[model samples]
Target chain A: AQSVTQPDARVTVSEGASLQLRCKYSYSGTPYLFWYVQYPRQGLQLLLKYYSGDPVVQGVNGFEAEFIKSNSSFHLRKASVHWSDSAVYFCAVMSNTGYQNFYFGKGTSLTVIP
Target chain B: EAGVTQSPRYAVLQEGQAVSFWCDPISGHDTLYWYQQPRDQGPQLLVYFRDEAVIDNSQLPSDRFSAVRPKGTNSTLKIQSAKQGDTATYLCASTPGTLYFGAGTRLSVL
Candidate 1:
């Protein structure tokens, strides 16, 4: 079964500080990875996705994630985070073959303190 | 284009009561999905359809839960008897390729 794991339940960082949210996935074959952000009282928004080449994928709002195949990890990073960046981040994985159902992680809640 | 839309932004129900959720996917999109998200947890897939045909509904609890996409445009999910464990936010999403999600309906069972 394909699954995603986000270790950190909550992360706190100061404004303008760098941020990195870790994610790990489990799948036998090739997997499609994604990062999504959910704000309070709103739906989730896709931040980035990794399908094939270019291990590093950039996303909206100055976010980026690197797909490390060997380690089975796709960690999200940002050079600097703003107060507005506070939200819950989810890591999802989709199988390349059969069903194509998305599996999500428990999510990491980020808090950017000013 | 308008994104996926879900009705009844919030629902409050007593145990044993019934509740229904409605979703309208993006125009021209053929696939629709339903997910359940518990407090502070990830979204779990319940069921999905492709143009009114159920692709997979293995995770759905058929005993008291039912879903339908009659015309392959709008969809509805109904729970016959609500339980405390059923309290969660119900999310609807659509995809042509990439997934687009609705604001979701927050459900609370007392």
Candidate 2:
């Protein structure tokens, strides 16, 4: 079964500090990977997606993710975290199971302190 | 120009009650998806449609849950009998190139 795993349930960091959210996926073949963020009282928004070619992809709001096929990981990273960036981050992988299914991680909640 | 739209931002019902959520996808989008997000959990796929045809619905609880995308545009998800375990946010998304989501309909079944 194709699945995404975000090991961290919650992470706290001081504003302006570097942030990294870890993600691991279980899939047999090459799958489409994505990072999504959900703010309070808002829908999930796409951050970035990786299909082929470059392993690192830039997303909106100064977010970026690198897909490492060997580790089966697609980790999200930010050089400087903003207070507004404090939200739940999810890692998703598009399944190749005939239907286009996006398997999502349970999500990691980030709390930024000023 | 508009994003995906979903109505009934919130719904509350007792066990055995019925509720229906509506969604209007982005104009010209052919693929629509419905997801259920419980508190502190990731969104799980419930069903999806390509145009007006059902592509996948294996995750949907057919005995109580039903979905339709008539005319390949607007869509609806109905729960014939709401359950306390069903308390979650129902999310609607459409895909043109990348997938975009609506704010979602939050449901609480007591």
Candidate 3:
């Protein structure tokens, strides 16, 4: 079965520090990967997505994610953390074939302390 | 684009009550999806439609849950008898390829 796993349930980092949120997926074929962030009491917002070409895809608010096919991972990264960047981040995967069911990881809660 | 729109920002109901949530996808998008998101958890797919046809609904709890995209533009998800375990945010999304989500309806069954 296709699934997404975000191993770290919570991550804390100081402002101005670099950030990385890990994600792993299980799929037999090429998968469409995505990263989304949800602020408190707000809906989710797309961060980035990867379909083909460059493994690293840029998204809004200086966020980016790299899709590593071999490792079945698509980890999200940010050069410098901002206090406002604290939010719940989710990793999702969807098959490129058939009904194209989408799967989401439990999500990683990131807290950036200033 | 107006993005996806969902009605009733919040709903509070007693167990066994029925509630419905509505969604209007972005204009011209053919695929619509419904997901249930528990507190602190990622959204879980309940059902999805391609145009007016159901593509996948395997995860939907048919015992009391039902969804419909009557005209392939607007959709509704109804829970016949709400349960305390059903307290969660219901999210609706649409896709050209990448999914676009709505603000969602937060349902609390007491």
Off by more than 4 A, model 2: A96-98
Specify the poorest-scoring 10-residue window by lDDT in model 2 chain A: A94-103
Clashes of each: 0, 0, 0
lDDT of 1: 0.94
Which residue runs of candidate 3 sit more than 4 Å off their true CA positions? none
Error of 2 at B70 (Å): 1.7
**How well does each candidate superpose onto the true structure, as a TM-score?**
0.98, 0.97, 0.98
Error of 3 at B18 (Å): 0.5
Instruction: Give per-residue CA lDDT, model 2, range B19-110, as digits (tens).
Output: 99999999999999999999999999999999999999999999999999989999999999999999999999998556799999999999
Q: Candidate 1 — which residues are off by over 4 angstroms?
A: none
Which residue pairs clash in candidate 2?
none
Clashes of 2: 0
DockQ of 3: 0.75
lDDT of 1 by residue, B23-109 (tens): 999999898999999999999999999999999999999999999999999999999999999999999999866779999999999
The residue-by-residue lDDT of candidate 3 on A1-114, one tens digit each, is 899999999999999999999999999889999998998877788898999999999999999999888899999999999999999999999889976678999999999999
lDDT of 3: 0.94
lDDT of 3 by residue, B86-106 (tens): 999999999877888999999
